[model samples]
Target: MGALADNRRFWLACNLVTLVLHAFGVYLYASEGFAHPVAQLWAIVLMLHMLEFPLAFIAVRERRIGWGVTIMATLIFGFTWWVPTRRGVFHA
Candidate 1:
């Protein structure tokens, strides 16, 4: 793999970490009701991710991807998942 591929992998790994953190944050909020500051931070991040959802929806639609998977992936990975996907990097 070249530099570009390595860069993409790095971003993908970051995305994975982001996903895990968000999930854990949500779990904390659900279980503890914002007792932790992380849970409060998660709410803000979720809102930001919600804003990214429409862009992800359009990108996935342009690629003729299914709505269900697109929704889940976009909610989880946001720009890191959709940008390269739109550029045909994953297919390449």
Candidate 2:
């Protein structure tokens, strides 16, 4: 395959790792009944972090979206969506 395709596949694999890691972390927290400091907050943040990529793009495309929001989202979602969609479109 081409370089772009290869690069995307690599990032997709990394995204999968991110998803699994966050899920595992959340699972550990849940197992403890979320008694630790900000465990609930961690769960919420990590889960949202996983979706931040796709959501950022959606935010950018919306007509009513603000530049500030888009910029912040882009910054937060950097490389998470950047690699997979580097070609101006994503494979999946």
Candidate 3:
């Protein structure tokens, strides 16, 4: 149906935007060499990048709870993993 097509387009657009942001974050991190202050933030962004695929899969399958949990896990992972690395608690 038309509505389904429209929804798909919307999701596609969202995914594109997310990818762009992730790519930009990567550029910033790589070019700057992942120093303090920005490293952790970049790490979180990277983790978010990793979560996109699984989240999209759940979304496309219409699994609401799965999508929610995936999103939450992404956030947790990003903060825990990325933030610490930025603070120099971990390397790579």
Provide the TM-score for each candidate, comma-separated.
0.74, 0.43, 0.38
lDDT of each: 0.75, 0.56, 0.49
Can you write out model 3's per-residue Cα lDDT over 1-69, one digit (the tens) per residue?
Answer: 445334544544545554565566677777775674455565766666576645444343432335554
lDDT tens readout by residue for model 2, 14-49: 667656655666676877767765567566655576
lDDT of 1 by residue, 5-76 (tens): 447677678788888879889899999988888898887776777788889878767688777767777677
Superpose all Cα atoms of candidate 2 onto the true structure and report the RMSD in Å to 1 decimal.
Answer: 7.3
Task: Record all residue pairs in model 1 with backbone atoms less than 3 Å apart, i.e. clashing.
Answer: none
| Candidate no. 2 TM-score | 0.43
- Model 3 clashing residue pairs (backbone): 40-86
For candidate 1, report its TM-score.
Answer: 0.74
Instruction: Give the number of colliding residue pairs in candidate 2.
Output: 0
